[model samples]
Target: MTFELLEKLENKINQAVETIALLQMEIEELKEDKANLAGKTEQLQSDNDRLNAEHQQWQERLSALVGKIEQAEENA
Candidate 1:
C-alpha cells in the first residue's frame, strides 16, 4: 500500500477508537441516571403509603366523632 493510503487507514482507526470511548462514557452516565431515578421512585412510593395511612386514621377519627354528635342530638 502507498504511504498515503496507510495514513488514511490509521486515521480512520483512531476515529473509531475515539467514538467507542465516547459511547462507553455515555452508557455509564445513563446507568447512573437510571439508578438515581429508581431510588427516587421508591422514596415517593413510601411517602405516598405513609400519607395514605395517616389519612385513613384521620377519617376513622372523624367518623367516630360524627357518630357521637348525632347520638347526642337524637337523645336531646
Candidate 2:
C-alpha cells in the first residue's frame, strides 16, 4: 500500500480506539446511576411497607373501639 493509505488507516484505528474508550466511560457512569436508583427504590419500598403496617394497626384499633361502643349501646 502507499504511504498515504497507511497513514489514513492508522488515523482511523486511533479514532476507533478513542471512541471505544469514551463509550466505556459512559457505560460505567450509567451503571453507577442504575445502582443508585436501585438503592433508592429499595428504601422507598421499605418505607411503604412500614407505613402500610402502621395503617393496618390503626384500622384494627379503630374497629375494636367501634365494636365496644356498639356493645355499650346495646347494653344500655
Candidate 2 regions with alpha-carbon error over 4 angstroms: none
The root-mean-square deviation over C-alpha atoms between each candidate and the true structure, in angstroms, is 1.7, 1.5
Q: Residue 50 CA error for candidate 1 (Å)?
A: 0.6
Q: Candidates' lDDT values, in order? A: 0.99, 0.99
Q: What lDDT would candidate 2 get against the real structure?
A: 0.99
Cα-based TM-score, every candidate: 0.82, 0.84
Residue 33 of candidate 2: its Cα lDDT?
A: 100
Any runs in candidate 1 off by more than 4 Å, and if so which?
A: none
lDDT of 1 by residue, 5-60 (tens): 99999999999999999999999999999999999999999999999999999999
